[model samples]
Target chain A: MDLDSQEQILKLSELHGPSQLMVIIGAPDPEAAEITAETVVQGDPSYAGVLAGAQLGLDVYHVLDESISSEVPPEVWDAQIGVMGDVLEADALVAAVAGMRQPGSDSS
Target chain B: MLEGRYVIALGERDGISGPAIAACAEAAGAKVVFVATECFV
Candidate 1:
Protein backbone atom coordinates (compact mmCIF):
# COMPACT_ATOMS: atom_id res chain seq x y z
CA MET A 1 0.00 0.00 0.00
CA ASP A 2 1.07 3.59 -0.60
CA LEU A 3 2.26 5.70 2.27
CA ASP A 4 -0.63 8.11 1.99
CA SER A 5 -3.20 5.36 1.95
CA GLN A 6 -1.56 3.73 4.94
CA GLU A 7 -1.58 7.01 6.77
CA GLN A 8 -5.26 7.46 6.09
CA ILE A 9 -6.03 3.98 7.33
CA LEU A 10 -4.02 4.60 10.47
CA LYS A 11 -5.77 7.86 11.16
CA LEU A 12 -9.16 6.31 10.65
CA SER A 13 -8.28 3.39 12.88
CA GLU A 14 -7.24 5.79 15.59
CA LEU A 15 -10.35 7.88 15.25
CA HIS A 16 -12.97 5.13 14.91
CA GLY A 17 -11.08 2.04 16.12
CA PRO A 18 -10.35 -0.95 13.90
CA SER A 19 -13.54 -2.76 14.82
CA GLN A 20 -15.64 -0.11 13.13
CA LEU A 21 -13.50 -0.08 9.98
CA MET A 22 -13.46 -2.34 6.96
CA VAL A 23 -10.98 -2.46 4.14
CA ILE A 24 -12.44 -3.58 0.82
CA ILE A 25 -10.00 -4.68 -1.87
CA GLY A 26 -10.74 -5.11 -5.58
CA ALA A 27 -7.40 -6.24 -7.01
CA PRO A 28 -7.81 -8.43 -10.11
CA ASP A 29 -5.64 -11.34 -8.97
CA PRO A 30 -5.39 -13.52 -5.89
CA GLU A 31 -1.79 -12.67 -5.02
CA ALA A 32 -2.44 -8.97 -5.09
CA ALA A 33 -5.55 -9.31 -3.05
CA GLU A 34 -3.75 -11.37 -0.43
CA ILE A 35 -0.97 -8.84 -0.20
CA THR A 36 -3.39 -5.97 0.22
CA ALA A 37 -5.41 -7.88 2.79
CA GLU A 38 -2.24 -8.69 4.71
CA THR A 39 -1.25 -5.07 4.69
CA VAL A 40 -4.46 -4.08 6.39
CA VAL A 41 -5.07 -7.01 8.71
CA GLN A 42 -1.64 -8.25 9.68
CA GLY A 43 0.76 -5.54 8.67
CA ASP A 44 2.57 -4.55 5.50
CA PRO A 45 4.37 -7.70 4.40
CA SER A 46 6.60 -5.77 2.04
CA TYR A 47 7.51 -3.40 4.92
CA ALA A 48 7.92 -0.57 2.42
CA GLY A 49 5.18 1.78 3.57
CA VAL A 50 3.64 3.32 6.65
CA LEU A 51 1.83 0.08 7.43
CA ALA A 52 5.15 -1.68 7.94
CA GLY A 53 4.99 -3.69 11.15
CA ALA A 54 1.75 -1.95 12.03
CA GLN A 55 -0.71 -4.65 12.92
CA LEU A 56 -3.96 -2.79 12.58
CA GLY A 57 -5.96 -6.03 12.52
CA LEU A 58 -8.61 -4.28 10.53
CA ASP A 59 -11.48 -6.17 8.89
CA VAL A 60 -10.71 -6.72 5.23
CA TYR A 61 -12.57 -8.26 2.31
CA HIS A 62 -12.38 -8.58 -1.43
CA VAL A 63 -15.02 -6.95 -3.54
CA LEU A 64 -15.85 -10.30 -5.16
CA ASP A 65 -15.93 -12.20 -1.88
CA GLU A 66 -19.34 -13.80 -1.44
CA SER A 67 -19.78 -12.33 2.02
CA ILE A 68 -19.41 -8.82 0.65
CA SER A 69 -20.93 -9.28 -2.80
CA SER A 70 -23.96 -11.01 -1.34
CA GLU A 71 -24.66 -7.96 0.78
CA VAL A 72 -24.77 -5.78 -2.30
CA PRO A 73 -27.88 -5.78 -4.45
CA PRO A 74 -27.65 -7.99 -7.50
CA GLU A 75 -28.23 -5.16 -9.92
CA VAL A 76 -25.60 -2.97 -8.30
CA TRP A 77 -23.05 -5.77 -8.27
CA ASP A 78 -23.74 -6.50 -11.91
CA ALA A 79 -23.22 -2.88 -12.77
CA GLN A 80 -20.07 -2.32 -10.70
CA ILE A 81 -18.18 -5.62 -10.69
CA GLY A 82 -19.89 -8.26 -12.78
CA VAL A 83 -17.85 -7.51 -15.91
CA MET A 84 -14.44 -8.13 -14.39
CA GLY A 85 -15.83 -10.88 -12.19
CA ASP A 86 -16.53 -12.76 -15.40
CA VAL A 87 -12.94 -12.44 -16.62
CA LEU A 88 -10.84 -12.57 -13.47
CA GLU A 89 -10.10 -15.55 -11.24
CA ALA A 90 -13.03 -14.67 -9.04
CA ASP A 91 -12.98 -17.80 -6.90
CA ALA A 92 -9.28 -17.60 -6.18
CA LEU A 93 -9.43 -13.91 -5.55
CA VAL A 94 -12.20 -14.39 -3.05
CA ALA A 95 -10.50 -17.29 -1.28
CA ALA A 96 -7.15 -15.56 -1.08
CA VAL A 97 -8.51 -12.67 0.93
CA ALA A 98 -10.93 -14.77 2.90
CA GLY A 99 -8.05 -16.94 4.01
CA MET A 100 -6.47 -13.91 5.62
CA ARG A 101 -9.49 -13.49 7.87
CA GLN A 102 -9.35 -16.96 9.32
CA PRO A 103 -6.62 -18.75 11.26
CA GLY A 104 -6.62 -22.14 9.52
CA SER A 105 -7.58 -21.31 5.95
CA ASP A 106 -5.64 -22.97 3.15
CA SER A 107 -5.47 -20.43 0.38
CA SER A 108 -1.95 -21.50 -0.54
CA MET B 1 -24.36 -6.56 7.16
CA LEU B 2 -22.40 -3.53 6.01
CA GLU B 3 -25.00 -1.11 7.28
CA GLY B 4 -23.41 1.77 9.24
CA ARG B 5 -19.93 0.35 8.70
CA TYR B 6 -17.02 2.55 7.72
CA VAL B 7 -15.20 1.44 4.55
CA ILE B 8 -11.90 2.04 2.86
CA ALA B 9 -11.94 0.88 -0.73
CA LEU B 10 -8.79 -0.14 -2.56
CA GLY B 11 -9.32 -1.04 -6.18
CA GLU B 12 -7.26 -2.05 -9.18
CA ARG B 13 -6.87 0.67 -11.73
CA ASP B 14 -7.20 -1.76 -14.62
CA GLY B 15 -10.01 -3.84 -13.21
CA ILE B 16 -12.70 -2.84 -10.71
CA SER B 17 -11.48 0.69 -9.90
CA GLY B 18 -11.99 2.64 -6.65
CA PRO B 19 -15.09 4.62 -7.51
CA ALA B 20 -16.89 1.49 -8.62
CA ILE B 21 -16.12 -0.30 -5.36
CA ALA B 22 -17.12 2.75 -3.37
CA ALA B 23 -20.47 2.85 -5.15
CA CYS B 24 -21.10 -0.79 -4.35
CA ALA B 25 -20.17 -0.28 -0.69
CA GLU B 26 -22.51 2.68 -0.53
CA ALA B 27 -25.30 0.58 -1.99
CA ALA B 28 -24.75 -1.81 0.90
CA GLY B 29 -25.04 1.12 3.35
CA ALA B 30 -21.34 1.52 4.12
CA LYS B 31 -19.93 4.94 4.81
CA VAL B 32 -16.88 5.09 2.60
CA VAL B 33 -14.03 7.04 4.11
CA PHE B 34 -11.54 6.71 1.27
CA VAL B 35 -11.14 5.30 -2.22
CA ALA B 36 -7.92 4.61 -4.09
CA THR B 37 -7.56 2.95 -7.48
CA GLU B 38 -3.98 1.70 -7.77
CA CYS B 39 -1.88 -0.49 -10.04
CA PHE B 40 -0.94 -3.69 -8.25
CA VAL B 41 1.76 -4.73 -10.64
Candidate 2:
Protein backbone atom coordinates (compact mmCIF):
# COMPACT_ATOMS: atom_id res chain seq x y z
CA MET A 1 0.00 0.00 0.00
CA ASP A 2 1.17 3.56 -0.70
CA LEU A 3 0.89 6.70 1.41
CA ASP A 4 -2.33 7.96 -0.18
CA SER A 5 -3.93 4.54 0.15
CA GLN A 6 -2.75 4.37 3.74
CA GLU A 7 -4.36 7.70 4.57
CA GLN A 8 -7.73 6.80 3.04
CA ILE A 9 -7.80 3.51 4.91
CA LEU A 10 -7.03 5.32 8.14
CA LYS A 11 -9.86 7.78 7.56
CA LEU A 12 -12.35 5.05 6.82
CA SER A 13 -11.14 2.93 9.74
CA GLU A 14 -11.84 5.84 12.05
CA LEU A 15 -15.26 6.15 10.51
CA HIS A 16 -16.06 2.41 10.61
CA GLY A 17 -15.56 2.07 14.36
CA PRO A 18 -15.18 -1.10 16.44
CA SER A 19 -16.72 -4.51 15.75
CA GLN A 20 -14.51 -5.54 12.93
CA LEU A 21 -16.43 -6.32 9.76
CA MET A 22 -15.46 -9.21 7.53
CA VAL A 23 -15.84 -8.17 3.86
CA ILE A 24 -15.64 -11.13 1.52
CA ILE A 25 -14.28 -10.43 -2.00
CA GLY A 26 -16.57 -13.09 -3.53
CA ALA A 27 -15.30 -14.35 -6.91
CA PRO A 28 -12.80 -11.53 -7.54
CA ASP A 29 -15.18 -9.69 -9.79
CA PRO A 30 -15.26 -5.92 -10.14
CA GLU A 31 -19.06 -6.14 -10.15
CA ALA A 32 -19.06 -7.16 -6.51
CA ALA A 33 -17.12 -4.07 -5.64
CA GLU A 34 -19.47 -1.95 -7.71
CA ILE A 35 -22.49 -3.38 -5.93
CA THR A 36 -20.80 -2.53 -2.67
CA ALA A 37 -20.11 0.98 -3.84
CA GLU A 38 -23.68 1.35 -4.99
CA THR A 39 -24.86 0.12 -1.61
CA VAL A 40 -22.73 2.68 0.14
CA VAL A 41 -24.00 5.45 -2.01
CA GLN A 42 -27.63 4.52 -1.45
CA GLY A 43 -27.61 2.89 1.98
CA ASP A 44 -27.77 4.54 5.37
CA PRO A 45 -24.99 4.57 8.00
CA SER A 46 -25.12 0.98 9.26
CA TYR A 47 -23.88 -0.49 5.99
CA ALA A 48 -22.21 2.64 4.80
CA GLY A 49 -19.25 2.89 7.18
CA VAL A 50 -17.85 -0.58 6.63
CA LEU A 51 -18.61 -0.45 2.94
CA ALA A 52 -16.80 2.86 2.79
CA GLY A 53 -13.72 1.23 4.21
CA ALA A 54 -13.75 -1.45 1.57
CA GLN A 55 -14.07 0.93 -1.38
CA LEU A 56 -11.26 -0.07 -3.73
CA GLY A 57 -11.19 2.68 -6.33
CA LEU A 58 -9.51 0.53 -8.96
CA ASP A 59 -7.66 -2.00 -6.88
CA VAL A 60 -8.77 -4.05 -3.91
CA TYR A 61 -5.71 -2.71 -2.09
CA HIS A 62 -7.75 0.45 -1.57
CA VAL A 63 -9.40 -0.67 1.67
CA LEU A 64 -9.21 0.22 5.32
CA ASP A 65 -7.65 -2.34 7.67
CA GLU A 66 -5.51 -2.84 10.82
CA SER A 67 -2.49 -1.41 9.12
CA ILE A 68 -4.04 2.05 9.34
CA SER A 69 -6.04 1.58 12.52
CA SER A 70 -2.94 2.23 14.63
CA GLU A 71 -3.05 5.90 13.69
CA VAL A 72 -6.68 6.14 14.72
CA PRO A 73 -9.02 5.18 17.50
CA PRO A 74 -11.45 2.32 17.16
CA GLU A 75 -15.09 3.28 16.75
CA VAL A 76 -18.37 1.39 16.97
CA TRP A 77 -20.14 0.21 13.87
CA ASP A 78 -23.82 1.16 14.06
CA ALA A 79 -25.51 -1.62 12.18
CA GLN A 80 -28.99 -0.93 10.89
CA ILE A 81 -31.65 -3.11 9.33
CA GLY A 82 -31.40 -2.35 5.69
CA VAL A 83 -34.14 -3.52 3.24
CA MET A 84 -33.37 -6.84 4.91
CA GLY A 85 -30.28 -8.39 6.55
CA ASP A 86 -27.89 -6.47 4.35
CA VAL A 87 -25.98 -4.47 6.92
CA LEU A 88 -23.54 -1.62 6.48
CA GLU A 89 -21.18 -3.45 8.79
CA ALA A 90 -21.13 -6.15 6.12
CA ASP A 91 -20.75 -4.78 2.62
CA ALA A 92 -20.42 -8.27 1.26
CA LEU A 93 -23.94 -9.64 1.34
CA VAL A 94 -24.82 -13.29 1.93
CA ALA A 95 -28.53 -13.86 1.68
CA ALA A 96 -30.56 -17.02 2.29
CA VAL A 97 -33.72 -16.74 0.22
CA ALA A 98 -36.60 -18.29 2.11
CA GLY A 99 -40.23 -17.97 1.12
CA MET A 100 -42.71 -15.62 2.77
CA ARG A 101 -43.61 -18.49 5.13
CA GLN A 102 -41.41 -20.68 7.30
CA PRO A 103 -41.45 -22.63 10.54
CA GLY A 104 -40.44 -19.82 12.89
CA SER A 105 -40.18 -16.47 11.13
CA ASP A 106 -42.04 -13.22 10.58
CA SER A 107 -43.95 -12.89 7.32
CA SER A 108 -46.52 -10.25 8.03
CA MET B 1 -44.71 -24.67 1.10
CA LEU B 2 -43.09 -21.24 1.48
CA GLU B 3 -39.82 -20.43 -0.27
CA GLY B 4 -38.85 -18.29 2.68
CA ARG B 5 -35.64 -16.28 2.52
CA TYR B 6 -33.15 -17.48 -0.05
CA VAL B 7 -29.84 -18.54 1.43
CA ILE B 8 -26.85 -17.08 -0.37
CA ALA B 9 -23.34 -18.44 0.18
CA LEU B 10 -20.42 -16.68 1.74
CA GLY B 11 -17.04 -18.36 1.73
CA GLU B 12 -15.41 -19.65 4.89
CA ARG B 13 -12.82 -17.77 6.99
CA ASP B 14 -14.64 -14.49 6.16
CA GLY B 15 -13.37 -14.59 2.62
CA ILE B 16 -15.19 -14.31 -0.71
CA SER B 17 -17.10 -17.26 -2.11
CA GLY B 18 -19.44 -17.44 -5.10
CA PRO B 19 -21.57 -14.75 -6.74
CA ALA B 20 -24.52 -15.85 -4.65
CA ILE B 21 -24.11 -12.95 -2.23
CA ALA B 22 -24.17 -10.32 -4.96
CA ALA B 23 -27.16 -11.95 -6.55
CA CYS B 24 -28.99 -11.95 -3.25
CA ALA B 25 -28.13 -8.33 -2.67
CA GLU B 26 -29.57 -7.29 -5.99
CA ALA B 27 -32.67 -9.37 -5.44
CA ALA B 28 -33.24 -8.09 -1.92
CA GLY B 29 -33.01 -4.46 -3.04
CA ALA B 30 -29.44 -4.22 -1.83
CA LYS B 31 -27.74 -1.08 -3.08
CA VAL B 32 -24.36 -2.35 -1.92
CA VAL B 33 -24.29 -5.79 -0.28
CA PHE B 34 -26.57 -8.14 1.64
CA VAL B 35 -25.79 -10.75 4.33
CA ALA B 36 -27.31 -14.20 4.84
CA THR B 37 -25.82 -16.63 7.34
CA GLU B 38 -26.85 -20.29 7.30
CA CYS B 39 -25.21 -23.61 8.20
CA PHE B 40 -25.49 -26.79 6.13
CA VAL B 41 -23.65 -29.70 7.64
Candidate 3:
Protein backbone atom coordinates (compact mmCIF):
# COMPACT_ATOMS: atom_id res chain seq x y z
CA MET A 1 0.00 0.00 0.00
CA ASP A 2 1.65 3.23 1.18
CA LEU A 3 5.33 3.48 1.97
CA ASP A 4 4.78 3.77 5.71
CA SER A 5 2.42 0.79 5.80
CA GLN A 6 4.80 -1.25 3.71
CA GLU A 7 7.65 -0.35 6.01
CA GLN A 8 5.55 -1.21 9.03
CA ILE A 9 4.70 -4.59 7.65
CA LEU A 10 8.31 -5.32 6.82
CA LYS A 11 9.46 -4.24 10.24
CA LEU A 12 6.81 -6.29 11.98
CA SER A 13 7.68 -9.27 9.81
CA GLU A 14 11.31 -9.05 10.80
CA LEU A 15 10.48 -8.73 14.47
CA HIS A 16 8.08 -11.67 14.47
CA GLY A 17 10.36 -14.09 12.65
CA PRO A 18 9.25 -16.24 9.71
CA SER A 19 7.51 -19.02 11.53
CA GLN A 20 4.07 -17.40 11.83
CA LEU A 21 1.75 -16.13 9.07
CA MET A 22 -1.61 -14.68 9.92
CA VAL A 23 -4.38 -14.05 7.42
CA ILE A 24 -7.53 -12.10 8.14
CA ILE A 25 -10.68 -12.53 6.03
CA GLY A 26 -13.81 -10.49 6.35
CA ALA A 27 -17.33 -11.17 5.05
CA PRO A 28 -20.72 -9.47 4.97
CA ASP A 29 -21.64 -11.24 8.14
CA PRO A 30 -19.77 -12.65 11.12
CA GLU A 31 -21.12 -16.13 10.44
CA ALA A 32 -19.87 -16.04 6.89
CA ALA A 33 -16.53 -14.77 8.06
CA GLU A 34 -16.21 -17.54 10.60
CA ILE A 35 -17.19 -20.09 7.98
CA THR A 36 -14.55 -18.76 5.65
CA ALA A 37 -11.98 -19.03 8.42
CA GLU A 38 -13.07 -22.58 9.19
CA THR A 39 -12.70 -23.49 5.54
CA VAL A 40 -9.19 -22.12 5.46
CA VAL A 41 -8.35 -23.95 8.65
CA GLN A 42 -10.21 -27.24 8.14
CA GLY A 43 -10.56 -27.62 4.39
CA ASP A 44 -8.90 -30.58 2.71
CA PRO A 45 -6.47 -28.23 1.02
CA SER A 46 -6.55 -25.82 3.89
CA TYR A 47 -4.32 -22.78 4.27
CA ALA A 48 -1.87 -24.92 6.19
CA GLY A 49 -2.32 -27.79 3.75
CA VAL A 50 -1.48 -25.64 0.76
CA LEU A 51 1.56 -24.10 2.44
CA ALA A 52 2.95 -27.50 3.43
CA GLY A 53 2.20 -28.78 -0.05
CA ALA A 54 4.36 -25.97 -1.35
CA GLN A 55 7.01 -26.50 1.34
CA LEU A 56 6.83 -22.90 2.51
CA GLY A 57 7.80 -23.84 6.08
CA LEU A 58 5.51 -21.26 7.74
CA ASP A 59 2.59 -21.66 10.06
CA VAL A 60 -0.78 -20.28 8.88
CA TYR A 61 -3.30 -18.75 11.23
CA HIS A 62 -6.80 -17.77 10.08
CA VAL A 63 -8.30 -14.77 11.86
CA LEU A 64 -12.02 -14.17 11.77
CA ASP A 65 -14.81 -12.78 13.98
CA GLU A 66 -13.52 -11.36 17.22
CA SER A 67 -10.08 -12.63 16.43
CA ILE A 68 -9.95 -10.30 13.46
CA SER A 69 -10.68 -7.27 15.60
CA SER A 70 -8.03 -8.24 18.11
CA GLU A 71 -5.33 -9.57 15.82
CA VAL A 72 -5.35 -7.80 12.46
CA PRO A 73 -4.50 -4.31 11.41
CA PRO A 74 -7.00 -2.61 9.09
CA GLU A 75 -4.76 -2.43 6.05
CA VAL A 76 -3.28 -5.89 6.29
CA TRP A 77 -6.71 -7.29 6.96
CA ASP A 78 -8.02 -5.76 3.77
CA ALA A 79 -5.07 -7.11 1.81
CA GLN A 80 -5.58 -10.61 3.20
CA ILE A 81 -9.25 -10.65 2.25
CA GLY A 82 -8.37 -9.66 -1.28
CA VAL A 83 -5.69 -12.32 -1.58
CA MET A 84 -7.57 -15.09 0.21
CA GLY A 85 -10.68 -14.51 -1.90
CA ASP A 86 -8.62 -15.10 -5.00
CA VAL A 87 -7.06 -18.19 -3.47
CA LEU A 88 -10.40 -19.66 -2.49
CA GLU A 89 -11.75 -19.21 -5.99
CA ALA A 90 -8.80 -20.55 -7.94
CA ASP A 91 -7.07 -23.89 -8.39
CA ALA A 92 -5.48 -25.06 -5.17
CA LEU A 93 -1.81 -25.19 -6.14
CA VAL A 94 -1.65 -21.94 -8.02
CA ALA A 95 -3.78 -20.09 -5.49
CA ALA A 96 -1.65 -21.34 -2.65
CA VAL A 97 1.48 -19.89 -4.18
CA ALA A 98 -0.29 -16.66 -4.92
CA GLY A 99 -1.68 -16.54 -1.41
CA MET A 100 1.75 -17.18 0.04
CA ARG A 101 3.32 -14.54 -2.14
CA GLN A 102 0.79 -11.80 -1.42
CA PRO A 103 1.60 -11.54 2.28
CA GLY A 104 5.30 -11.81 1.61
CA SER A 105 5.03 -8.75 -0.59
CA ASP A 106 2.43 -6.84 1.36
CA SER A 107 3.35 -7.80 4.91
CA SER A 108 6.49 -9.98 5.16
CA MET B 1 4.67 -29.05 29.08
CA LEU B 2 3.24 -25.60 29.66
CA GLU B 3 1.09 -25.57 32.70
CA GLY B 4 -1.47 -22.80 33.11
CA ARG B 5 -0.10 -21.04 30.10
CA TYR B 6 -1.73 -19.88 26.91
CA VAL B 7 0.35 -21.59 24.27
CA ILE B 8 0.47 -20.88 20.59
CA ALA B 9 2.55 -23.31 18.59
CA LEU B 10 3.74 -22.47 15.13
CA GLY B 11 4.55 -25.67 13.29
CA GLU B 12 5.03 -27.32 9.94
CA ARG B 13 2.10 -29.12 8.41
CA ASP B 14 4.26 -31.99 7.20
CA GLY B 15 5.67 -32.57 10.67
CA ILE B 16 4.27 -33.89 13.94
CA SER B 17 5.39 -31.00 16.12
CA GLY B 18 2.16 -29.02 15.91
CA PRO B 19 0.00 -31.78 17.32
CA ALA B 20 2.66 -32.91 19.68
CA ILE B 21 2.87 -29.39 21.02
CA ALA B 22 -0.86 -29.27 21.40
CA ALA B 23 -0.84 -32.56 23.27
CA CYS B 24 1.93 -31.39 25.51
CA ALA B 25 0.07 -28.18 26.17
CA GLU B 26 -3.01 -30.15 27.10
CA ALA B 27 -1.12 -32.43 29.44
CA ALA B 28 0.36 -29.43 31.13
CA GLY B 29 -2.96 -27.74 31.79
CA ALA B 30 -2.33 -25.07 29.24
CA LYS B 31 -4.60 -23.67 26.57
CA VAL B 32 -3.19 -24.32 23.16
CA VAL B 33 -3.61 -22.56 19.85
CA PHE B 34 -1.92 -24.30 16.97
CA VAL B 35 -1.09 -22.79 13.61
CA ALA B 36 0.73 -24.65 10.84
CA THR B 37 1.98 -24.10 7.33
CA GLU B 38 0.47 -27.38 6.18
CA CYS B 39 -1.62 -30.23 7.46
CA PHE B 40 -2.38 -33.84 6.42
CA VAL B 41 -5.14 -34.04 3.87
TM-score of model 3 (CA atoms): 0.24
Task: Give the candidate order by descending DockQ.
Answer: 1, 2, 3
Best of the two (1, 2) by lDDT: 1
User: What TM-score goes with each of the models?
Assistant: 0.91, 0.20, 0.24
The best candidate in terms of DockQ:
1
What fraction of the reference interface contacts is present in each model, in order?
A: 0.77, 0.13, 0.00
Instruction: Give the lDDT of residue A43 in candidate 2.
Output: 26
1 or 2, greater by TM-score: 1
Record all residue pairs in model 3 with backbone atoms less than 3 Å apart, i.e. clashing. A48-B38, B13-B38
Candidate with best lDDT = 1
Task: Encode model 1's per-residue lDDT on A5-81: one tens digit a residue.
Answer: 88888898888777678889989878989999999888889888888998888888888887788889989999888
Candidate 2 chain A least-lDDT 10 residues = A93-102
**Candidate 3 CA-lDDT value:** 0.34
DockQ of 3: 0.03
In order, the first chain's TM-score in every candidate is 0.88, 0.20, 0.27
In model 2, the Cα lDDT at residue A53 comes to 47
Candidate 1's error at A45, in angstroms? 1.3
Kindly report which residue stretches of model 3 are placed more than 4 angstroms away from their true locations once superposed. Answer: A1-108, B37-41
Docking class of 2: incorrect
Q: Alpha-carbon error at A85 in model 3, in Å?
A: 39
